[model samples]
Target: MASGMILAGLGLATIGFGARFIIKQMPTMGQKLAEATKTFPKMDSKAFANSKYYKGGFEPKMNKREASLILGVSQTASQQKVRANYKKLMLLNHPDRGGSPYVSAKISEAKDLLDKN
Candidate 1:
């Protein structure tokens, strides 16, 4: 019957549309999965803490010039400016926020040296 043929055609069209929709969404789904995997890697916190790069308690000795250079401030920078810069750098380089421990250690050392001056 013509009506039966029309119904079959409609069903085929609906299935085709559904398939196209799924195919169109595949690339976006794949990209989201890739980004999720890349952003959150399997990082063991305990292992990172015990790593050689970790400098939790020990403070390294650094001169005023070295500290100034590390903090990206001039040798004549005021204490307030140094403290502000230190806080900014700490926020950026804190080990808990996906920053490297080694870099954070250097930043802390720079702050300590500047504070002592």
Candidate 2:
């Protein structure tokens, strides 16, 4: 009976310790969440929804990151490499050659955007 009482007391002490630790951490967790919300735009916002890079849908305006993905090159790829890759992609996806017009157009747009950067 004394052993059972001791075990119960130890369990209560452990729970109290855990509760205190969690309570102490709560403030920091809340602060980090606050900082994150301030640092990034909400995912549901129109800007985020329409983003070509983040949302994974192509847009009329090409972002550098999106352009890099479309061209299969690094974001910092040189203009010459961009052009070469563009040509290769166009050869495969150009509409006249039975490839996707949409894809071909995106490839061209990506090269142009990257060249300008």
Candidate 3:
């Protein structure tokens, strides 16, 4: 009888865990979770750009100056243009899309410099 009770509890626990996983994986639930958060941290754009993290063989070095050129803009590109270029480059080198984070971060840095200056 004790063994049967243990088996039943384990089965119930397994079912509960499976149900929880399915519910959490739902796209609506994920969106709701993102929106429900009131205070999420913002990405630090400047430091991200200046860091040497993004230079992973796609170029000899990654710098904001180079990024500005890649976006077909000058170092004097306006903040708005910098933002637009960053988005365009991100789409091409997004780590989640199989691109390197180091490259992405360099692109981010370049955009930040243009935005700040």
The candidate maximizing lDDT is 2
What is each predicted model's overall lDDT from 0 to 1?
0.85, 0.88, 0.77
User: What's the alpha carbon RMSD for model 1?
Assistant: 11.2
lDDT of candidate 2 over 42-101, digit per residue (tens): 565675665656454786677898899989899999988999999999999989999998
How much lDDT does candidate 3 score? Answer: 0.77
Error of 3 at 108 (Å): 0.7
Query: Per-residue CA lDDT of candidate 3, range 1-117, in tens?
Result: 999999999999999999999987899877888787856666787647878554544356646667666666887777777788778889999999999898787777667656766
Give the lDDT ranking, best first: 2, 1, 3
TM-score of structure candidate 1: 0.47
| Model 3 residue 64 CA deviation in Å | 5.8
Ranked candidates (TM-score, high to low): 2, 1, 3
For model 1 the local lDDT of residue 56 reads 43
Question: TM-score for each prediction?
Answer: 0.47, 0.50, 0.43
- Worst lDDT 10-window in candidate 3: 53-62
lDDT of 1 at 111: 84
Better of 1 and 3 by lDDT: 1
Which candidate number has the best TM-score?
Answer: 2
